[model samples]
Target: MQRDALSLSQYIVYRNGVPAGARGGLRNMFHRAFGAATFAGFWRHWNPIFGYVLGRYIYSPLQRVVPRPLALILTFVVCGAVHDLVTMAVRGAPAFFFVPWFVLLGTGVVLGRAVGLDLSGRPWVARAAANLAYVLACLAITLAGECFIW
Candidate 1:
């Protein structure tokens, strides 16, 4: 598999069109993520820093060994596990929120791609709304699972 040669700073600039510490960087990140036309595109735009590491360190290696769909889901699971670790450390208790949350998001991306979901030609507002809705729906499901199941 080909590796991304861009350094972290370069990746951020390339993805966000601005330097990491530049004013409006956060705004740009949100605009790009929410403005994306698909759920996968949203993940692509969400956090250039985390995405870079996850892509290079986690997803790429898994992709080499597993099927793409399974790799994608496992990547999210690993990412969420890291987040949960931090949450558990900070709260001094076990945390289970992010794993299922990220799993749903990953599944959404897989299903969206399988269905050929694309909103690139739609109006920007419409695209943003759809992307936001997908994210919120995943969060809602995760919250419900946490309350009822976990």
Candidate 2:
């Protein structure tokens, strides 16, 4: 259970980090080519910066309280819950899709840790494997939920 939680948290952080990086890149592009204002660029990069700060100050501090996996799981569940609430309110989508995705993400983190996957060393392969695992796991979970879990 603990391990599961920790994995989830790690996955959440990673997912958020990717999009944040992309946003930051886009902002940088605009600033470089179009002479966008600092304030606008800052706003564009805010997500990544915010995620980094949260992981460093809040998430890291909280992680020490539990085993790595459990910590990840708890953090991810919270993140998933928040996403669900926001999506439901803002987009009127059912909150169910997040559950499976979070579960899959948690599983991926555990597997990666167990295998000692070095994402930085083998970027393309590592990302492909991780993402494939994530997608498959999520699909399976969602299918199960639709068939019986729910």
Candidate 3:
């Protein structure tokens, strides 16, 4: 299934669900590929491996070992850092990209715990609502920070 991309910027503007930012296809592809490659490098450095051993041995069971919420938070934090680093490399504004993305990830984790996946295996509607709320809350926090800080 094709998943919709969440728009961190839109969430702040709408005070509703996350919105997708407009981007050229090529640019979006490059950004996604760069982000993926960076994160892959980080993953390899953190947990070195290769081949079927990598997927089956290293990754598969790792998720089961940790609580879902903790894992989600950690993964998003790492992803945010990867995205921030890529943005810095491409745009030369490291701190600006880094701070917002890092904060966004942290916000996502807190929101997830507070809403998304927190309900006890409820209906799909409930889960989706929670996730939507989580995204909105994160954006709100980001906007608040931007307003007060700069």
Q: Could you say which candidate leads in TM-score?
A: 1
lDDT of 2 by residue, 12-127 (tens): 34434334345555444333322212222221233444444445554566789977777665555655666678889998867666755665656566656677654444444444
Arrange candidates by lDDT, highest first: which order? 1, 2, 3
Which residues of candidate 3, in runs, are more than 4 Å off?
Answer: 1-75, 95-117
TM-scores, in order shown?
0.95, 0.54, 0.40
C-alpha RMSD of each candidate structure in angstroms: 1.6, 11.1, 13.2
Clash pairs, model 2 backbone: 2-69, 2-70, 3-69, 3-70, 5-72, 5-73, 6-69, 6-72, 6-73, 9-72
Put down candidate 1 lDDT per residue, 19-135, tens digits, no spaces. 898998899999999888888888987898999999999998899999999999999999999999999999999899999999999999999999999999998899899998998
Give the alpha carbon lDDT tens digit for every residue of 4-43 in model 3. 1323343222221222343443343333322322223222
- Which of the two candidates, 1 or 2, achieves a greater lDDT against the reference? 1
**Which ten-residue region of model 3 has the weakest summed lDDT?**
42-51
Give one clash count per candidate, in the order shown: 0, 10, 0
* lDDT scores of the candidates, listed in order: 0.91, 0.51, 0.43
